[model samples]
Target: MTSPTPQAPVRRPTAADGFVVVDKPQGWTSHDVVGRLRRLAGTRKVGHAGTLDPMATGVLVLGIGKATRLLTYVVGADKDYDATVRLGVATTTDDAEGQVLSVAGPGAVEGVDRPALDAAVADLTGDIQQVPTSVSAIKVDGKRAYALARAGESVELRARPVTVSRFEVLAVRQVTATVADGGPDVPVVDIDVRVTVSSGTYVRALARDLGAALGTGGHLTALRRTRVGGYDLAGARTLDELEKQADADGTLATLPMAEAARATFPVRELDEDEVRALGYGQWVAPSGRPEVVAAISPSGELVALLEDTRRRGDDLARPVLVLAAH
Candidate 1:
């Protein structure tokens, strides 16, 4: 008789509320990270603010316990990426992982110099209409676009407005490349770039458009996200690091929900009287800052997320989400 495999010990749930900034490894899906974290954090409430593609690697923000409620606002924040776009080849998925669609003729990609590349980059900067890559996670009629595309369905997505606040070329390299469509090796120009764009902007789509505009088909070869809203690589920890930390003492360095709120939104410290009224769901006077503001107690606890709105004719800062009990 064979001995059964040793089962791992399951840690008890702690239900601690906070966020974990993970330096997501390549090949691990966003859900894959969350599933692993569910085990490490000793809770099933682990959730991420944004989904990073398996090919992309960098900072991925995760929320624990009640922190999941704050992820919606985080999803709307701007993003930054460091990507390499190879001008000379196009791919079915607009990235290196996809099969090549076409290859540029010899000397075609080389003809695109610094000035030409800059002009193309300029054209992509600022607010522009962008069609998300077909393999993206966008949903069509409730089915994920990627899911449909993977199943051999033709996907035609529409263009939408997105702001590319900054698009700067960091370096350029000239070399020969192989085509994924089984074509002969061709000369290619690889342009390394960094972009800061509004939420929902597709960097892969930008690579496709950049190549199309230059008349020398292109696709993303590498992508690494450096920043997401207020959270950046500087604050991130690797999954291995987190796992070791968890094993050492069943603990993690989580950003408390109040600190996370303050990091993402401006604060409005409330007095004792306002705190009492807010506990009952009553509206308080406006705190000057527009949009969603974090309402904190003088003692530094985040009480709720508040928004100023007009009720009848009077303006009041109503509680959008109450975080604390009386």
Candidate 2:
């Protein structure tokens, strides 16, 4: 008689290197997503490119393993968001989460017509100086502005120049609603807008400024990020999906680091000897790409991220981050 023995299934490696586009759910802090991914990925090396407010949702870029070093570039990339700005009321934080600061008078929203809105949006377009809301993540005096604001301290953030690449108004609707602002109910105007701004720009502040320009108070009622640089919602996966993937297979899907680098920066291939030399922390010749470039080996592996720097009066390729030895 012949007997067969069952064998254990092979476990795939969990230590991965690449990016994960997350469709972050509302009410979850950016740090919450990072911590959850760390547990799911079975590594504490996970990091995010940018932070999203707890009320916002959509594309949140995460880096695992060696890709964590590339988050700087992603963090500075252009961003897109779909937001709703209520023009009849203002808030302490310039967002819905804060207490009502002031409310516009009756019939105040009627003056905010399409022409007026367009002109105000145009004023905000191009390069403009903007002061972030006091309840923001900006650091002041070695402490977070929000922390200070929450502790009953006045947080006065300085105005910084930021670019509003696009401020497209998708739709606008005026709604009359009741309010509990320690007074009788009043009419309100809510404007739906989509904005594309520079990395440091604040969409909530835009709503506040727009209301101020229109003689009505403003606050962001809703916000959802749709894109970050080249990454968008199309490539993003929700947290539930990630957990399901982990349950099905003891690993979460991640974009290959080499492929992610190729998609992000200019590629510069290295010969057999060059890849090996860089593996030993040696520098290569000028890549001619000027800024950072992905140094790929002949086998198509991302050896490192290289940048040209003036050393010894010569433009030489220096490793910005060494991802692999060979």
Candidate 3:
């Protein structure tokens, strides 16, 4: 019997197709934004660079069509957050979302002056191992840590190395509030902090660690991501604005793939031949830079991600991601 006719390979979208930076609203999960974008863009190929907690609001880099290749690079870049940490209480999730596990009495944490807070923040800066919150998205035994914790399982995550480039206390205030159990009143000290940390670093963990250092419980009250790599809230379009633009033009507001890559990383321009070779996933000569750089064509099109690989005495460079031909 004759075999069935060979089917043609599905054609993927081109690098010209990329993502839009969105200022996600509170209570909307990252997946929710992606779903909206998929409908807005009239395409199913939509993804985000990173995941943000539902309570967090800030810049979320999205990838459209073939630009999804850029997510890997974006995900590894440094991140910045402006957050509020509430002292005098600890929670199961390390944030305002979870149940209160413990409460320090009113004025339990006095004498936490600005100087002391500054010193605490200083100690958190630089390279350190951080234990992610039990309710984090990290997977344990192929299941999300948060899922396990929610199921009443005791989760103990190991500390992982992370870099906190900056941790500054912007403001601090002490306030009184009633507990959920209708118990006696309590005093809570709220600290506003701005942090810049490497990938995988948890802002909630930072708050928890800070409280641990101060001998008082703490948890994140609010968090707003300000920056992700080169994308910042300054350039993000809100969902309402995005919907307006989509309705007005019947086309989604998307950043060009080449532009996105260049904005996020250094660029190396390639000639027509090099571009062709890259599109075919072939190797090229080193550009003398050891870092991974986005390779673009003369016409402002992203061709591939190029990086140098050294083996013995030979230095070879190759494309990590080959974008579709322009």
lDDT of 2 by residue, 1-326 (tens): 77888887544456588899999999999999999898777788999988999999999999998889889988988999999999989988899899888888877887778899899999999899999989889999999999999998999999999999899888888787655746676788888898999999999999999999999989998999999988999989999999898788778889888877876788998998888888998888989876788899888888998988888898789997888874
What is the C-alpha local distance difference test score of candidate 1?
A: 0.90
For all candidates, what are the clash counts? 0, 0, 0
Ranking by TM-score: 1, 2, 3
Per residue, candidate 1 scores C-alpha lDDT tens digits across 1-326 of 99999998867557478898999999999999999888877788989988998999998999998888999999999999999999999998999999888888867787898898899999999999999999988899899899999898989899999999999999999988877448567899999999999999999999999999999999999999999888999999999998887777656668888889987888999999988889889999997777899998988888889999999899899999988877
Compared with the true structure, what per-residue lDDT tens digits does model 3 show for residues 214-246?
A: 777889989999999999988999988987887
Off by over 4 Å in 2: 1-15, 181-184
Q: Which pairs clash in model 3?
A: none
| 62: Cα error in model 1, Å | 0.7
Candidate 3 has a TM-score of: 0.92
Model 1, C-alpha of 195: deviation from truth (Å): 0.5
Report the Cα lDDT for candidate 3. 0.86
At residue 77, candidate 2 shows an lDDT of 86
Computed on alpha carbons, the lDDT of every model, listed in order, comes to: 0.90, 0.89, 0.86
True lDDT of residue 213, candidate 2: 94
